[model samples]
Target: MPFSLSIIAEAWPTFEAGLITTAIFCSVASVLGLVLAVPIALAQFSRSWPWRVSAKVLVEIVRDTPFLVQVFVIYFVFPATGIPMSSTVAGILALTIHGAVYFSESIRGAILSVPKGQVDAARAAGMSYPLTMRRIVFPQMMGYVLPPIGNQIVGLIKDSAVLSIISVPELSMAFQNVLGTTFAAPEAFVAVAVLYWLLTSAVTLVMSRLEQLTPTHRSTQEMTSLLAKADR
Candidate 1:
C-alpha cells in the first residue's frame, strides 16, 4: 500500500496533545519517583533492621508484580475503597510508585558502590552521619546512579503507553483514536512510534551529556595520580 503523508499531517494535532500529556506525566512521575526513591534507598541501607526490612519489602512487592496489575489496583481497587482518581492521575501515580521501587534499588546500589574507606574517612573527620552522606556519599553516588536512572526514565517513557488501557490519552491512545477515526492504522502507529523514538532519543542524549560533565572516580583517580607525580 502506498503511504500518504497527508494522513500524518491531518493527525498531527491529536498526536501533539497526546505527546504533551505523555511528557507531563513523565516529568511529574520522574520528579516524584526521585523524591520517593532517596528515602527508601537510605532506609534500605539503614543500620536498623526494621527500616531496612520495610524498605526492602516495599521494593520487592512493587518489582515482582506486573505494572498493569498495579495500575488496576490504583485505578479500580482504590476507587472501590473510596479513593477516586482520574485516569491521568491514576496513571501518573501508578507509574511513579512503580518507578520509585526500581529507582530506589539503583540508588541503594550506587550508595553501596561508594568506597568503604571514603565513609570511614568522613567519619574520622568527625562528620555527622547526615552531613557525611550529604557531602561525601551522595556526590559519589550520583556518578553511579545517573546511568541507570537514565535507563529507567527511558523505560518509563515507553511504559507510558500501557496507560492507554486505562484511558489516559497518552501517545498510544492518540494513535488508537486517530486509527479509529480515519482507519489509517499504519500511518497513525508509525507517527506515534516516531514520536516515542524522538522522546526517548532526546532523553538519552541529554543524559549522555550529563554523564560526560559529571566527574567519575576514574577521572578523580587520574587527577590524584597526576598530582602525586607532580610532587616527585
Candidate 2:
C-alpha cells in the first residue's frame, strides 16, 4: 500500500475543529470541576457526620460508575425529567461531575495531610476556623494538591474522547470521520494518538515547571532554618 499524506492533509481541517472543541470541553470541565470540588472537599472534611457521609456517598457513586454511563444518563435520562440538553452540554456536565468527585478527594487528602499541629497553632493564635483555613491550611494544601490536580486535568483531556460516543465531534469523532472518508484507519488513528501525546506532554511539562516554582517542603524549610541557626 502506498503512503498517503493526502489523507492527513485533507482531514486537517476536521481534526483542527475537533481539537478546538475538545480543548473547550476540557477547559470548561476543569474549571467547573474545580468549582464543584472545593465545596465537596470541604463537606468531606466537615465536622458534621451528615455532611461527610453525603459527600462520601456522592463521591463513591460517581467514582464507582463508568464515565460513559454517566454521559448516557445525563444525555438520555435527563430529557425525561423535562431538562433537555444537547449532547455536548450533557457530555460536558458528565465530565465535569466525574472530575469533580475525583478532584474533591484529592483536595480532601491534601487538606488532611497538613499536620494537626498547624491547625492547633492557628487556633491558639486566636484565628477563626475559616480564617485559619484560609490563611494557613489552604496555602499549604495547594502545594500538595496541585500535582494530582494536574494529573486529573490530563485524564480529563483523554476522557473527553468518550464524548464522541454521544456525537460531540471531539477528536475521536473526527478521527472516525476521517477513517470513514479515506478508509485510512491506521494513519488517522496514528495522527490522533500523536496529537493526544503532544497534549499530555505539554500538560506534564507545565506541571513540572509549576512544581519547581512552588515553595520547598516543610523538611526543606526546617533544614534551612537549622543551617541558618548554625551559621549564626
Candidate 3:
C-alpha cells in the first residue's frame, strides 16, 4: 500500500509531453467545434424543411451516440473508405465533430428561447435573416447561451482524454505507458487526474470572467426600441 510521487518524477518528460499534447488537442478541437457549430445551429432554424431536418438529424446522431464509438469509427473503421489518416488526425476529427454537435444544440436552444415577437418585428421591418439574427436574436441569446457553452467547453477539455483510445499519445496514453513500465498505477493516474482538474478549472475560471465582462441585457431593449421606431 505504499505510494510515491517519485514514479512521476522519474518519467517527467513523457508526462510533460502528454500534457502539452492534451492542451493543444483540447484547444484546437474546441475552437473548431465552436466555429462549425454556429452555422449548423442556425441551419436548424432554417426556413427550408430539408435543411432544418438534416441539421437536426446530424445534431441528434452525434449527441445520442457515445464518444468512444465515434472515435473508434473515425480512427479504425474510417480508413476502410480508402482515405487513411494518422491516429492524431482521426482523433482530432472525432473530437471536433462530437463537440460541434453538442455546441450546436446549446446554440439552437438559446436561439429558440428568444421571444417570438422580436423575430416577427425584425421580419416585419424587412430585416434580412442574417441581420435580424445579429441585431435582434444574438443580443438576448448571448446571456442564455454563455453558461451552457462554458459547460460544453469544459466537457471538450475533459473528453480529450478519449483521444488516447485511438492511441493519439494524449495525457492518458502517456500515463498508461508509465503504468506499463513502472507498475505505479496510483501515482501515474493521480498525476493525470490532477492535470485534468487543473485544465478544466482554468476553463471555468476564464468563462466566469467572460460572463462578468458581458454587458447587461440593455442591448436587447435597445434593439426592441429600434424596431418600434422603425415600425412607425
Candidate 4:
C-alpha cells in the first residue's frame, strides 16, 4: 500500500486519547513541579545549614542525571523498596521531580536578579520576611522568571514522551501501539510529532501572552504604595 492520509484518519482515536493523556500528565506535572520549585528555590537561601545543603544536593542530583534513568529508577526500583506506584503515578512523579529541579534553578536565578537594595528597603520599611517576599521580591521576580519558566514547560512536554518506556499510554506510546498494528512507521511517527508540536505551540502561545501581561511594574507600584503606607 502507498502512503495515505487514511492511515492517520483511522488512527485518530488512538492519537486523540494519547494526546489527552499527555496533556494531563504535562499539565499536572507542570503545576506541581513549579509549585514544588518555589520551596526548593527558597530553601537554598535558608538560614539553616541543613536546608541549604539538602536543597543544593537535590538540585544537583536531579539536574545532573538523565531523565530516562530517573524514570526507570522510579518505575522499576522503588517498587522493590516498598514504595510501590502505578505506571501513571510513577510517570507523573518522574516528570515532576525532573521539572522541579530545573524550575528551581530558574527560580533561584530570578530571585537573585531581584535587587538586594529593594529587599533591604522593604525590610527597612518594616516589612516582615514573608510580607516582603509576597509584596516585593516575588512580583519583580516573576518577569525575569517567566521566560525561562515558559521554556521549561515546553521542554517538560517533550520529556513526557519518555514516560512511554514505562507504559504510561502517552502520545509516544499511543503511536507505538498504532505502529505495532499498522506497521506504518512514517504515518504514526509523523502524526505523533505533529501532535507534540501542536501541544507545545499552544503552551508557548499562552506563555507569550502571560509574558506580555506580566504585571511587574504595576505590582511594584501597588506594593510600593502599600509599603509606603506601612512606613507612615
Candidate 5:
C-alpha cells in the first residue's frame, strides 16, 4: 500500500505512550547525570591520586566504549551476577552513567576555563574550597557549560532510542511495533522523526534561554574586581 497518514493516526496511541516514556526516563536520567557528574568532575581536582585516577578511569571507559555495549552489559549480563533489574530501570541506569561521564568532562572543562587567579584570590582571602567554588567558580562556569550540556541533553534523547533493543517502550520501539503491525515503513518513520525533532528542538530552545539568563563574563569580572578591592 502507498504511504498514508491514516496509518500514523492509527498508531498515535502507541507513539504517544512511547514518547511519554522516553520523556520521563530521559528527564530523570539527565538530572541524575548532572548531579552525579559534579562530584566526579570535582574529584579530578582532588589532591588524592586514587580519587583522581578513579574518576578519570570512569570517564575514559564510558567515553571510549560504545553506548550499545554498555546497555547490553547492564541489561543482559548483570542478571547473571544477581543484579536483576527491569528494562526500564536498566535503561535509566545506563543513560544516567553514560550522561554522567560525558557531562562530567564538560563540567571539568568549564571549571578549567574559569581563570585560576580568581581561585587563588579566593584562597588568599580565607575562602574555603567549597566557598570558592560556589561564589567564584560556579557562576562563571555556567556560561561556558550550558551549550555543551544542551548538546548532551539532545544526544541523551537520541540515545534513548537504543534502549528499544531491550524492549524499553520508547519512540523507536513504538515505531517498530507500528511497523510490525502495519508495515508502513515510510509513514511510521516519518512520524517518529518529526516527534524526535520536536523533542530535541524544545530542549535546545530551553537551553538557549538558560544561556541568556546565566551571568555573563562581565558580571563575573565585576564580582572578582570587588573581591580584589576587598582583599586590598
Candidate 6:
C-alpha cells in the first residue's frame, strides 16, 4: 500500500503544539539535567564516601529502572504522598532526572580526561575552583564530551515522546489523537517520525562539527578513527 502524508496537513495544529511542547521539554530538561549532572559527576570523584555513594545510588537507580516506570511513579504514585504536580511538571522532572544520570557518566569521563597540568596551571594562576572549572576544565571537557553529550540529548529527545503516556500531549500523543480520530495512523506516525528525525539529525550535525573543531585529542589515533568512521 502506498503511504500518504496528506492527512497530516488537516491535523497540523495538534502536531505543531506537540512539536513545540517536545522542544520545550527537551530544551529545559537538557539544560537543567546537565546542570544537575555536573555535581553528580563531580561527587563520584570526591574524597567523601557518602557523597560518592549517594551519587552512585541515584545514578544506579535511574539507570536500572525503566523510564516508563519512573514516569508512572512520579505522575501516579507521588500524588498519594500529597505532593501534587501537573502532568507537564511531572514529565519534566522525570525526564530531567533520568537524563541527568546518563549525562553524569559522560561528564565524569570528560573530567577524568582533563589533563592534570591544565588544572594545576589554573590554580597557580590565582583562579578560584569555580573559575578554573568554568574557564579551563569545562571548555576542555566539552571537546571530549560533546559527541556523547549530543548522543544523550538526541536519545533524550526521542525519549521525551514517552511523556505522552502521562497525558502531556507531546508528539506521540498528538499522533495518537490523529490516529484515533481520523484513522490515518500511517500519515500521523510518518509525520511524527520525520519530525523526530529532523530534530535528532540537526543535533548530530552540530555535534559532529564540534567534535571536529574541538581539540580533545588525548589520543590522536582515536580522533583519526572517528574521522574515518565519518567518512564511511
Query: Per-residue CA lDDT of candidate 6, range 81-152, in tens?
Result: 999989999999999998899999999999888877877888999998889888888877877788889999
CA lDDT, every model vs. true structure: 0.90, 0.88, 0.86, 0.92, 0.93, 0.88
Report the number of the highest-lDDT candidate.
5
Q: Model 2 off-target regions past 4 Å? A: 217-232
Q: Write the per-residue lDDT of candidate 4 for residues 1-232, one digit (tens) a residue.
A: 6787899999999999999999999999999999999999999999999999999999999988999999988988999999978999999999999999999999999898887888899999999999999988888888889889989999999999989998999999999999999999888888999999999999999998998887865445567998999999
Candidate 2, residue 141: how far the Cα is off, in Å: 2.0
Off by over 4 Å in 5: 219-232
Q: Candidate order by lDDT, highest to lowest?
A: 5, 4, 1, 2, 6, 3
* C-alpha lDDT (0 to 100) for residue 188 of candidate 2: 95
Error of 2 at 85 (Å): 1.4
Best-matching candidate per TM-score: 5
Question: Candidate 1 vs candidate 4: which has greater lDDT?
Answer: 4
Across residues 1-232, which tens digit of lDDT does each residue of candidate 5 receive?
Answer: 6878988998999999999999998899999999999999999999999999999999999989899999998988889899888998899999999999989999999999898998999999999999999999999899889999999999999999999998999999999999899988999989999999989999999999999999776446768898999999
Off by over 4 Å in 4: 218-232
- Estimate TM-scores for all models: 0.91, 0.91, 0.89, 0.91, 0.92, 0.84
In Å, residue 77's CA in model 3 sits off its true spot by: 3.5
Q: In each prediction, how many residue pairs overlap at the backbone (N, C-alpha, C within less than 3 A)? A: 0, 0, 0, 0, 0, 0
Model 2 alpha-carbon miss at residue 28, Å: 0.7
| Tens-place lDDT digits, model 2, residues 1-232 | 6667788888899999988888889889989999999999999778999999999999999989898999998999999999989997898899899989989989999988888788899999999989998888887777788899999989999999999999999899999999899989878988899888877788789888987887744534566898999999
Model 6 compared with the native: what TM-score?
Answer: 0.84
User: What local lDDT does model 6 show for residue 34?
Assistant: 90
**What TM-score would you give candidate 1 relative to the actual structure?**
0.91
Q: What lDDT, from 0 to 1, does candidate 1 have?
A: 0.90
Better of 2 and 5 by TM-score: 5
Task: Report how far residue 98 has shifted in candidate 2, in Å.
Answer: 0.9
Worst 10 residues of 6 by lDDT: 214-223
